[model samples]
Target: MNNAKRRIDLVLLPIVLLAAILNGYGIWNDQYANSYYTTAVGSMLRNFHNFFYASLDSAGSVTVDKPPVVFWIQTAFAYVFGLHGWSVILPQVLAGIGSVLLIYFMVKPTFGLAAARISALAMATVPVVAAVSRTNNIDSMLVFTLLLGSWFLFKGTKQGSPWRILVAFALIGLAFNMKMLQAYMILPAFYIFYMLAFQAKWRKKIILLIGSTAVLAVVSLSWAVTVDSIPESQRPYIGSSETNSVLELAFGYNGLSRLTGQQNRAAGAGMPNAADDRNNRDNASASVQGSGQTGNSAPSGNPSDDVGMGEMGRGMNGMNFPQGGQMPNGGEMPNGRDFGGGNGGGMGGMFGTGEKGLLRLFQTELSGQASWLLPTVLLGCIALFAGLRRRNITMKHKEAAFWLIWLLPVGAFFSVAGFFHQYYLIMLAPPIAALTGAGFVAMWKAYRERNGWQAWLLPLSVMFTTIFGWYIMQVYNDTIGAGWSISELIAGFLMTIILIVMLNSSHPWKQGMVIAGFMVMLIGPVYWAFTPITYGGNSMIPAAGPTGSNGMFGGMGMGGRQGNGNVGMTPPNASGDADQSFPSSSSDESDVDNSGTGTPPASGGNMFGGGGMGAAGGRGGAGSRNEEVDTTTLNYLREHNTGETYLFATTDYNQAAPYIIDENEAVITLGGFSGSDPVYTTEELEELVQSGQVKYFMVGGMGGRGGNSDISNWIVEHGTEIPTSEWTTGTDSGAGFGGQSTLYEVKL
Candidate 1:
């Protein structure tokens, strides 16, 4: 190889290695990463039918709320590697590394080695990207598939081959199957870029775009067509859908609901949105009330009621409290109109919140994690346009246009989009990194030539980034104490001085200043990413950064304070009473991040506060025990399965996932996730009981999932509630299922 090529290879190798280390370092630490999906993977490994539907149980009773593409890849690895946590998560890690390498090659062909190296490193260190890649979540796969499509498109645009363009759109179709509509966000850029860059006549260009669009549609819907074609009886129920249809699940729950915020509450028996879910959880109790049952009903009140505030220090299950001040004289909340709040949280509200409009993406909860470099990236895109003005559009210009289009639309969408997890921002990382790389080089060239606009641009970008970095760290400081923010500020100040000195110094120092600026800005996010790996963070609502990580604090409180490790998700201290930081049960959704799975509530501006990390600790620790199965309850399930296809059935997948994962048995969920999707009618359930397909029904309550009132009501009326003490320990262990899972044997 030539000198320049060899040097490029050397830089590329280390960046790739860095990405692998970031993703692979604590692989074994989080054994059952995101137990909700991990359980589904375990079930999919059982047989072909379950595999095809992405079923959450061996009996093929119900499917996960997501598409099957991610599970398909995870299952293939489990098939070859024998189904360990490492095996399940291996695909994402490999995909992440491959993404970095692909980006390097894609940029190297156009922007050269310097831009390629910058882009690769920028993406490699992004906190949320590392967080998702290290777990079984499919966002990494979606990102990889999209990047892969970009690679093919890059080749097609260069070669002027229609077939290559067809392949490019086809890969995007594959990406669609991975993440539903999210994969389509970049298509406009892909189309416009191809049109501008393709060496073809106008008529030919339109024909090519039309052909690719057709290929895109055909490939995107192929899996949906086949799955929908299967008879409902033979396939698993589509979780989270109002109707038992994958297409509806995709178009409604996963598609339109995300944009319009018009939730099809036709399924979830009208549980209030995520915010009200938190209020209901706090003011009420986990115990459900029925004839001759010991559960408590909710008090008639709004979210502002302090009825149950004093019980916050009790335990993670947020139940078993003495009810008086918070309820009526009989230890029950006064009956009234249905709970307030709307249908949000869960899968339907993927991109919504009470907040909206342009600045929404910059909220503290979002900025600290994914948006650490967002401002600079946006400025870089603008700088690219300004620098290239009045010039004929070359292949490079078209490439720049593509990256900007890919970035701005998605950025604007998230800014104003209603509800979404912070990790969803991973989709924007690549384009941001690419634009920053190209913009930096262009600005640097102009600066070397003493061009006034370019000279000011580079320093101004660095200066603005330093100020933003300091602000983000300050937010981190307030949310998670221990003076971390001050440290970041000091470091940033030192870097700013170095940048100023280098900019004014001789030739050798100018390049060094650029490297310093990137490093200084990267310091905070890189540390945040490391926090999850070190302190351990894998939740249904996955986040990254110090706020996302379980930190130096022993236990977290709902107000985002350090607790005595009693009432929070962490085990109580030696004393039963907790450190008096706050009070409320674990059931309160506000205390938890809830992003990793189920229906995450509308996450507003907790952006920099590490507020979610407090709840992340309640998820139990990393390692083999991470799955948090109640051994006593699991053994009861195994012994009494009695030749039934399902070992037990619960209200929703979150309630059933631990048992399915721990026992590797078919633990069916009656209503699917959010307890909104009707997996089985009461009549159908009775038929299953008669056929011996199900026996023990694990009931009582599940957060957000109590939406399936009919099934819950049916089980209460027909099934015999086994006394809590009979089958397992009555005390809440602060682990899986919170309190003892209230079990009931269906009477034949």
Candidate 2:
């Protein structure tokens, strides 16, 4: 019997892992997330592994927003493939898939095969899980590294492998570098409780504690030195301390300042998160601790006073509060992020006037900020249930409680930090999934004890059926649209019926239920892979990209609206309006100290910022360089001497498009977008053309910003016909436009 079980485990492990991988495949078909470009891709380009590839800043300082451990994978790819989109993001997708597999491995002993399989399947199809798994971002890396570290510790304790403890601690170090200290949340607490519960011997205890600490210090501190060695100027700060530079910006203040209001930057259009975080920290600390971070101010007479009772003080007791003036009627927010002025304090106006000078507290607080506590309450219930059946639960749980305990901290950490993004809590979903799967088995047995199987089976399965329907309609709607064919519809219904017939019964029934669920969802997801994707559940890929740099990812059916009321994608190059200016700056490090002797590279300015090539910018004179390049592209542009320039359009509507990688194959879909997708902005086109930099412009579906104002007014006004012979902007050498786009060129 034991040999047969071992054989079965070996066979099923590969099958399950392969399926998890397939779940992430085709996720990069469109731009779906933001970090793909800024943090993830930037890391790939700047670091060629060997610690620090080259600093991005021209002054040559260490860039330290994120730890280098995660970037190591991204840079390794960049070293060979040259910082293309696909290569940078692929690692994230694999890591996400790997995390799912790890969850299954961790929970299998406690939950039994049927429950473990169901949990993995649920995780694979859960909408947020599926969406995040496909992007090039650190959140997935954070989760994977955390789980890897947990599995090592849990398995090591059970298997008596001390080496595994060192490895787990090392992973925690890597996770710290990937996403700050959030990686270490479970350690001290988990260790203390585990030791007390398991009754550790002194030698074993010292080895686990001391050796793990040493491993952590070595792995984590190395990145600290490499990052801290950087100078101050290259760092980004509306106003954060240097001891608190981008390093603090990325990890500490970067994450916590937003919630605590250290940076006064508010959430909204025109307001970067920096201001709310930078300023609010002082304000919030003042409000909560009385005087300031120095711990001055007097204690409040009432523990539930205004600021104390209101949104700002919600986290003092591990609560989440609404930001700004919330709806009086207790309405839910559209997005988890609060886009208002008064910071994370709920109903900003209600508490008092929007006073930067004083911290005013309100009596009533809403529920969002405190959302992290939901899992704790859930764990409490689970613990109570397990305690009732302590004998049954103990032997059935190989390491189930360990995983449950580990999963609980992510929420506690978020709650204490007071930073709340609904989906950021998606990190908690895997464990919840594991718990629920295991819980169902335990619940089913209890239910059967009361009602002899048949009575409970139909209702329980129906409940799952209802949950899946909700997921399809709301969560997975991007893939499985409102439209369901007869075959899919019938299969879905039949599967539900089969589950109803089998639920709450023993293993045979559970096996049948799973097989039916797998067949139904597994096939439905494959269909979602090829269809036109949506953004926030609206529109196809934009003709124009999103607002600002590295804004929204993925294709929306209609072009995305910009924050400045530019309706539909990135504004085109053709703009007479100075209100809409290019992101150009004298400060772009790419331009400083660069001296190219020959014809300048496609980039408009010299490689480094200071001094110009030739007469002003490069070694070659301005007029002698090739004049046939495109000016419409983002990220890079090649300059020509004849007053004409070309844009390869590297940053498509959203830079989700691919660069001209040789052989035209994507390394990874950064946000799952090819970046080659056709997109344009009339504002960008007109502005460059009028300035004489844009002799020709590439026009496609991307030019919908400000609601056709550029094309209807500016492009139509400034553009005129010229013969092909004189049209050196290459209007005739037309590039094929794809995905609801039209290409056009202008003559100067």
lDDT of each: 0.58, 0.36
Which lDDT tens digits does candidate 1 get at residues 396-504? Answer: 7889888889988998877655435556778888887787778777666655655666565666666676677667667555455746656556666676566555555
Residue-pair clashes per prediction, in order, are 25, 106
Q: In model 2, how large is the Cα lDDT of residue 188?
A: 58
RMSD of each: 7.8, 15.9
TM-score of each: 0.81, 0.54
Identify the leading candidate in terms of lDDT: 1
